[model samples]
Target: MLWWVLGGAALLVVAVVVTGVVLFVVAAGKSDRVWGVDDVAVGECVTVSGEDEPVVRKVSCDSTDFHFAVALKADPGVCAAKNYSRLWFGEGDSSDSFGKWARDGLCLAHVYQQGRCYHLPSSKETNALADVREIDCSSPPATGAGENYEVESKVSGMPECSEEQAEYFTEKPTPTGYCLRLLE
Candidate 1:
């Protein structure tokens, strides 16, 4: 009876250990999920001006720790005034479309500082209390405006960007310019 009890206890311990190992492996796989952009969908964008959800994409580059996110959002005040411009979301291989918008709108306010991105208020003097980057996509041509976008690390998934700001994601556009963080 004593030997049987010991064996049962040992088996319990082994089961617990295996469970822990599996959990750790799963978490490790998701660690990279925090580092990419999502595709864009109409639901994510505001209908009035065709503004998509605000996005916050992290810039990955030459071993330099750039802890910042990009945002794109719309100001209803801007749209109410017949501003045909729209906000767009950019991910890996989807950055250029925002630049070629036929609406001739400015989606993102290029920031050089180190911090979170956010939306500009109706006043144009203050940003909304949200930390994100806003892009415009109101016109149909604006949808395909981006041509310089590209996807880099398949292992790392799409470029690591904050999804809290975005409402859509797309693999169609490739990222370009300085946004595509290339490892040297």
Candidate 2:
């Protein structure tokens, strides 16, 4: 009788340990799961790369590599607003089968943090947010090398910037905008 009780207790302990391990493994897998453009929702963060053919990957909001947030997931040309970058799928590639995964591409908005300085296009010929790169505020670029702007505030919708000389960078769907003042 004593042996049977001891054996039963051992089995219960083993079962509990196995169950815990399985749960942990499942949770970890879910957390590490990579998401495609269609798999992501609005408000989630993502990193965008490539020039001709852009490669976008969904990432954690806190990730350092995160460049934009999914403002909206809609058809092509739906993100026709200033400062909102559109990533259209099924363009260039003529594969008919690829059309299935072509719908609901991403409309990404630049993730700008207040107080941070970034190098933006100064000329009217180029997109304002093109070639955006973070730069040290203490030491700005020389006069002909791109414009340096410091993000003053982030606001929703099209509210007028408090700073008189602040430039606006607005996104559609989400309608989040950033007020950037030229760093002189």
Candidate 3:
């Protein structure tokens, strides 16, 4: 009887331990799972697609496909004060519904990794964010294109970049900016 009781108790303990471990592992995996645009929260990374009706999906910050980090999820006008780029939830809609669509969108900021090179949009380009593209630092510059800029440092608010470096500002939560220099 004693042996049976001890064995039963040990088995119960082992079961509970296994259950706890399983639960922990499941939760950790979910945290890294891709989330829908509406479900994603601030500080999470996302990739934007589709020009007509831009599709946004949450992705791991460290993922190679990561494009932008969510700065704010609110009306377009609310983001005007900040330096974030806007992606309306319902773009290409009629002018009558413009206000409603503008009220539902996400404010995104580029994920400017240090030492990476990028080709920024020209002043004439209407949609700056859509034109921003990453480039290989080792490769030669593209023909007749704007100069490629390499991220030198990232800082909060407006960065005090040198004369050779240009300041790229964005608002993730508060004011944040980056110092970029021409990629030679």
> Which model scores highest in TM-score?
3
Arrange candidates by TM-score, descending: 3, 2, 1
- TM-scores across all candidates? 0.26, 0.58, 0.61
Between candidates 1 and 3, the one scoring higher on lDDT is: 3
So what's the TM-score on candidate 2?
0.58
Question: 112-183, model 3: which lDDT tens digit per residue?
Answer: 777788876553433445556778878846735456788898787778889988887985655678998886
Measured by lDDT, the strongest candidate is 3
Residues 54-170, candidate 1: write the lDDT tens digits: 333323422222122222334323432431233333323323223322222223222222222223233221122122233222211221212212222222113344432221222
Q: What is the lDDT of residue 128 in candidate 3?
A: 45
TM-score computed on alpha carbons, candidate 3: 0.61
What RMSD value applies to candidate 2?
A: 6.4
Off by over 4 Å in 1: 33-36, 39-65, 73-111, 114-184
- For residues 31-108, could you state the per-residue lDDT of candidate 2 as single tens digits? 522245556778887665444344556677776532677777777656665446655555454322122235556666
- Tell me the spans in candidate 2 whose CA falls farther than 4 Å from its real position: 32-34, 47-67, 80-82, 88-104, 119-133, 140-147, 159-166, 171-173, 182-184
Residue 168 alpha-carbon offset, candidate 2, angstroms: 3.6
Worst 10 residues of 2 by lDDT: 92-101
Clashes of 1: 42
lDDT of 2 at 34: 27
On the 0 to 100 scale, the lDDT of residue 66 in model 2 is 22
